[model samples]
Target: MGRPRVRFTGRTEADAEAVLAAAAAHDACLSGAPADWEIPAGCAA
Candidate 1:
């Protein structure tokens, strides 16, 4: 098993942020141990 991957695509910054936040929130919720949800380096929102 491996970490889940989410692909986010949006035209506007607001929409991109929304998707990014949603992905992070979902990832955090699914994690069994304390995890860092910081946006990955080089990621553009």
Candidate 2:
């Protein structure tokens, strides 16, 4: 069997962050992601 999946969509950055936080709470491994990615122009929060 394959692992179950969950998806979230948000129109704002804060909404996106909330969804990400919820997912991470359920899976500790998700909280260890790298933080070296760059945000493109006008995409900065």
Flag regions of model 2 displaced more than 4 Å: 29-45
**Clash pairs detected, candidate 2:** none
For model 1, which pairs clash? none
Model 2 over residues 21-44: C-alpha lDDT tens digits? 645543543333323232222233
lDDT values, one for every candidate: 0.54, 0.43
lDDT of 1 by residue, 10-31 (tens): 4457466656666666577655
C-alpha TM-scores of all predictions? 0.37, 0.36
Quote model 2's TM-score. Answer: 0.36
Instruction: Provide the lDDT at 43 for model 2.
Output: 31
| Model 1, runs deviating above 4 Å | 31-45
Structural RMSD, model 1: 8.3
Which structure among the candidates has the greatest TM-score? 1
